[model samples]
Target chain A: MTQNLDLTDIQGNIVKAYGSSGFFKARYLFLRVDDGDKGRDFVGAITSKVTSANEKLKGDDALTVTTNMAFTYAGLQALELPTASLVGFPSDFVMGMSKRKDILGDDGPSDPKYWDKIWQEKVHIWISINGKTSDVVEERYQWILQQIKATGGVTLLRGHCGEDGNGNAVDDLPYQDASVLYEKDGVTPTAKEHFGYTDGIGDPVFDGQTNNAARVIGRGKLTRSGDWVPLATGEFILGHVDEAMEYPQTAPRPDLLSNNGTYMVYRKLHENVGTFNKFLDEQSKDYPGGKELLAAKFSGRWRDNGAPLVHTPDNESKAEWDKKFAAADDATQKRMLTDFTYNEDISGAKCPFSAHTRRINPRGSLEYGVKDAFHTPGALVDRRRILRRGLPYGKVKDETSDKGNHGIIFMALNADIKRQFEFVQQQWINYANDFKQGNDKEVLLGNHSSKDPGKVVLQVEPGSGKPPHFVNNIPRLVETRGGDYFFIPSIGALKLIAGGLVDPT
Target chain B: MSNIAGKAYAMNVITPIPWYKVWLNRLIFWAALKIPNVLNGLLTLSLIHYARWVIIPRDKFPRLDPSQPKEDLNYSYMLFFSNFNGSWDQYVDSFTFAIPSGLDLFWKMNVKYPKSVPLTPFHNYIQHNQIDTAHYYNAYPMAASNDVKSAKNVKKALIDFNAASSNKSPDEFLEDYNKLLNQLQNDFGEMRPTPIVSLAAQAVKERVMEEQRQSH
Candidate 1:
C-alpha cells in the first residue's frame, strides 16, 4: 500500500495576519550543494524522516524543498506529489528565510560584521553517510547542529552565481544579514509591503486541541462542540482547520496533533517606494494635501485601517468611523460584504475602489455574480490565502538617503499554488478591475495602480475605475531580490534529519 | 527468499515466462526513479537563487499577515490551512456535503454518467444515481457520530430503491414532481405559489451557455 504523509497541520507560531512588532521579522538565506548524489542522498535521508514525522504531526505536505534536491529516491516520490514541474538543475545557493537579529548589523565577537556575514547564516554539518535510509539523514542532521556548536559562531550569507552576457562568472555579493528589531523610535510596523498599509484584517479561525473557545463567539462558531470545522485564528499566525485540511494525504496520529506546523516560503520583494511616491505627487494636483490623497488611493484606508468611503476631509468624525467599523457577528459581516453587487461602498464613499485591503480580500464583491456565491467555500478562497511571513531588511542609511534596498520576504503556503498565491497576484492584485463600487487596482503593489511610470497614487479615485492616484513618501521601498520554496518538517522529521539511516537495525 | 539474499552472484538472469513484460517492468521502474531524480534536482536549483549575490540562510521565519488584530486571527495561516486538524478525511470527503435531498433529482449526473454509457432512462436514473450518503459520511472517519446517523438514513433509503421502479426515466421523475405539485395544490387549495424547479432549470441553462463561452 502506498503511504503518503500530509504536513499541513503543523502551524507556524507567528502567522502574518496579526500585526508584528519586532523580534519576528523574516530573514532569508540561499545556498546550493555541490554533488547531486550526495545532496539527494542527504535530502532523501532527511526528508523522509521529516515528512514521516509530519505525517505523524499532520504537517504541510508540499515538496517545496526536496523536489529541488540533487537526487530523489522513488520511495520518496511515492510520498510527495509534484505540483510545480521541475525546470532544470539546482543552483549552488539554495535560499531560506529567517528572523533578523536584535540589530541589522554583524555583531558576533570575531568579525565586526559577523552578524551580517554570509557564512554565519548557514546551518552546516558534516555527513559521511549514503543510502535512502531515514536513520542516516536524522543522525547527520543532528550532527550538523552539533558541529555548528563545536565551531564558534559563523556567519553564512546567500548569493547567486551565474554566467553574465559575456559568459563571465557573475557572482552577486553576499547580502549583509541583519534584523529590523533594533531600530530605535522607528516602529517596524507589522504591515504588508510598499503601500505602508495594514493587511490581513480578517482571517479564518482554527480550533485544534488547544482551548481557543474565547476566540469563537457569534457567527465565529461554525462547528458544534468537538465538531471539526474551520476557524480564523488571526493573520501572520496559524490559520484554521479547513486551511490545514488542504495539506494532508491521510489522517494524522493524535499525539502529533497539537501545535505542529508547516514550513514557510520566504522571498525578498523590492518595492519602488520613491518612484511610486513621485508619480502620486505629480498626478493629484487637485486634491488638498495630495500626498495624503495618494496614500488614500493605494491604501484604501488612511494609515489606520479607516476607510475614506465614509469620511471626507470635512466629515472625518470618530462616530462615523465607529458606526461603519462595528465588528458585528460573522453572518452579518458576511451578509453585508457578500450581498452587494457594486463595490459595497458606492461613490467610493467609505473605502476607495483601489485600496490594498479590498484588492487582497475583496471579501464579498469578487464572488457576487457567481453560482454558489453564499458559500465562501475553501476552493474559492484558498487561492487568495498566502502564508505571508518576513520582515523589512536593510536601513534608510540616512533618512535623506536617495536610494535604498528594502523589501519584504513574502512567504505563502497552499495546496495548489495556482489557486492560492498565484491567483491572488494574477487575478486579484494585477487584474481585478472592480473595487467597492467599480474599477482601479491597489495603488501600492497592484499592477493597475502602478501603470503610469511617472504618477504614483497613494489612493486611487473612488469609482473612477482608473489606476491608483499617485502619492509621495519613500521611493523603491521594497524590491524583489530573490525567492525560493522550502519544506519544514515536524520534530519527527527533524529527528530523521539528525539521525543517519540504519541497515535494518 | 533466503537463498536469493545469501548468494549475491549474478547481476542478470533470465526468466522463462516473457521478455516483453520483464522489459516493461524494468522500463516502468527506471522511468519512475529517474524522472523524479531529474525533477528533484532541477527544483532544488530554483531554491538556490540570490538577490545581489548573497546567500539567504535557513531558519525560523514569520507567517500570515503581520498587520491584522490578534483577536481576528484564529491560528497561523499555515496551521489553519495546513494539516492542523490532523486528518485527510476533511479534504477527501470535502465533496460529500450535498447528497441530493432537494427537488433537483438529476443533480450531479455527470458523476453518474460516463462516455461509454452516455445517459440512463429517467426512472432507472434514480436507482443508479441514488447518492450513498452513508458512503459519503463514512468517507470521513473522524466525522461526528450524529452526522453518521443522518447520513446512514439517507443511504438506506437510496440503496433500497430499485432502478426500474421509481426513478427509471427522466420523464418519470418529472412526472413525480408534477404529482407532488398537484398534491400541494390540492392540499393548500386556498393559496398557491409557483414552484422553484423551473426557475433553477432556466438559471442552469444560462450558466451552461456562459461556461461554454468561457471555455472557448
Candidate 2:
C-alpha cells in the first residue's frame, strides 16, 4: 500500500532541509515578469540552476550552493500558464495569503497593511538561493541579478526604502537574508533561533523522503500496535494519494503541471523578544519553580535545549535532563530530542494543553484519553502535518528592545493549505475548545491583545501537591509582517511553464 | 459549555429553505434514510456520531402563548444537527470532501447556499447559519462514537468467553483467555481522561486538592 517517492522529481529544498545540509546563508528575492517571452526565457535560464531531489550533494559534485524557485498565482498568470491549468489550482493558493486573512486570523496588528513595503504590490515569482558561506550566497544572488538584468522583461521587486546606519538606502539588492544563529565564536551554526532554543526538532518523516530509515521511529506515525510507520508521501507532495488515500480534487491538471508540486506558506513572523523576556521576568516572580519552569510551560520544550517536558517532568529533573543531553551518543541524543509522547501526562501537568509545540503537532496526544481509539493514535494529526521550511531572518542585536527587525521566516510546505495549514492555524493556534482550553490560545503565537487579557493555566502533577498556577496578562509573542502562498512546481512543471507547453485544450 | 462532552462536539445549523424546494429536500432525506447505500460516502467519513435533518414549514411555526405573535414566514426552515469528533474545520472539510454530491443535494436548496467547492465560500455559508448548542449530553464522555460501538462487540465477546471457560482446567482456561484476547485485540484498551478538560476545571481540582492537603 506504499509507493516509493520519485526522489528525482521533487525540488531540492523540498527534499533537503537546507540548514542541516550546511547551507546556513540564504538570500530570498521576488521577481516580477514585465514581458512574457523574456519571462519564459528567464525561467528557461534558471531551469538548470534549480536543484532537484536527486542532485549529488556529498561528493565532488557537491551542492555548495542551492537554488529553488516558486510562483504565486499572479506569477503563474504572469508566466501565461493556460486557463484550464490555472483554474485547477487550489482556491487558497489562487486567493493568496493576504486575501484569505479572515480564515487565517491575520487581523489586528498582523494585517496585510503591516506587511513589508515590498509586499504592497503582488510579485510574480519567488527565488531563493542557499549556500554554505556568505560568498557563495552573494555569488548566487549576483548571478540571479544578472539573469534579471539580461532578461529585459524581468525586474527586481524592492522592499521598504529604509535607511541603513550610514544613511544609505538598504535592500538595494531587493533581497532578504535568513541565516542560522551562530555561537559566540561565530564559526559554527548552533541551529538556534533568536529565542535561544535548539530548534528544528521532530520534522515528519514521510515514506521515501530521506535515507535515514531510523527517523521513522520518532518522526513517523505511531500505529495501533505501537509500531512506527512512515506517513504517506502524498501528505506533503502533490500528484499522490494523501493520508485519506484520495487525490485532492484541486490538483492542477494536464497532470504533469501539478505533479510533484507543493504549496509553500511564506510568513515573516516578528518575535517580540523584549516583551517576551519582560513578561517572563514579571510572571516568574512569586512563582514556585521560577522563570525556567514558566518558559518550559509555554512551549513544552526546555528553552536551553529542545528537550520535551515529558522527559523532564519537573524543574529539578529538567535541569538534570539538560546536562545529560550533551554527553549522550548521536542515536540517544536524537531520541532525547524528538521521541516521547504526552499520553502519560494526560492532564497536561508536564506539558500544558496550550503549549506551542503541543498545539502545533499534538503528536497523537489529542487521542490520549482513549488508547487505540483509531488504528493509529495520530490519525487526526497525520493529515495535518506540514513540513516547516523556514529560517530565522534577522539577528538579535539588542535583547532588551521589543521593537526590532528580528524573527522567523516561517514557511510551511503542505499538500493542501486549507486542510492542513489553514486548519492548524484556525482550529488549533487561533481558536480554543479543541484542546479543551476554552478560547485560550497557544502561548508563543497567541496574538494576545489587552482586551483579551491573555490568561492561561500552568499545571504541575497533583501528586506534587502544587496548585495549577493561573498565569495572567500574557503578551503577544509573534506578529506577521508579510507573506503569501507560493507553488513550488516540479522540474517537469517548470520546463512546461518555461516552454509554454502547458495546454488546457 | 454543554456542547462538548469529551471527544464529541454537537453542531446545530438552521437555514431557511425555499417553499418550492422544501418537499424536494424532504424527499431527498427520505430516500437517503430508506436507501442507506446512498449515504455510503457519508458513513465512510467516520467522524460523524449522529446526524439528522428536520424541516419546519413556514405555517408550522408553533404558537403556544396568546402574547406571542403568530408566525407568518415565506420560507420553511431546515434544521441540521450532528455530534462529531475533532475540530469544526476537520468535520466540515471532511464532509465536503467525503461526499460533495451528497452535501450539495442536502444543502443545495437552502437560501444563499454556496456549493461545497472552493471551500471558503462554503465554510462561510455554514458559519453564517450555524447556531451553538445551548445544552448537550453524551453518556460516554471519555469515548468517541467508534469506541461506543466497539465496546458493544467487546461486551458480547466477553460474555461468550466467560460461559465457555467455566469448566476448563488451568491450562485450558489460559488457552481460552488467549483466544478471547485474539478475538478482541482492538478493544483491549480502556479510555482515560484527556489532559485538562478546561482551565476552570483544573482550577477547581487544584483548589479541592489544596483544601484536602490543608485539612490533612
Candidate with best DockQ: 2
Alpha carbon lDDT of residue B84, candidate 1?
10
Against the unseen true structure, what C-alpha lDDT does each candidate score? 0.32, 0.77
Record all residue pairs in model 2 with backbone atoms less than 3 Å apart, i.e. clashing: none
Off by over 4 Å in 2: A160-173, A462-465, B1-80, B83-89, B92-216
Q: Can you give the TM-score per candidate against the true fold? A: 0.44, 0.74
Give a tens-digit lDDT track for model 1, residues A37-97: 3433444443333322122212354221111111111111222222121111011112222
Model 2, global lDDT: 0.77
Candidate 1, residue A28: how far the Cα is off, in Å: 2.9
True contacts kept of each: 0.00, 0.01
lDDT of 1 by residue, B14-69 (tens): 11212223334344435535654322221211111111111111121233686743
lDDT at B182, model 1:
28
Tens-digit lDDT string for candidate 2 (B1-216): 445666677899999999999889988889888974676555544557888889989888777887889778989999898998765767876666445678788988899988876466788988999998776777877665556666787899889988999789998887777666545433432343332233344456579789999999
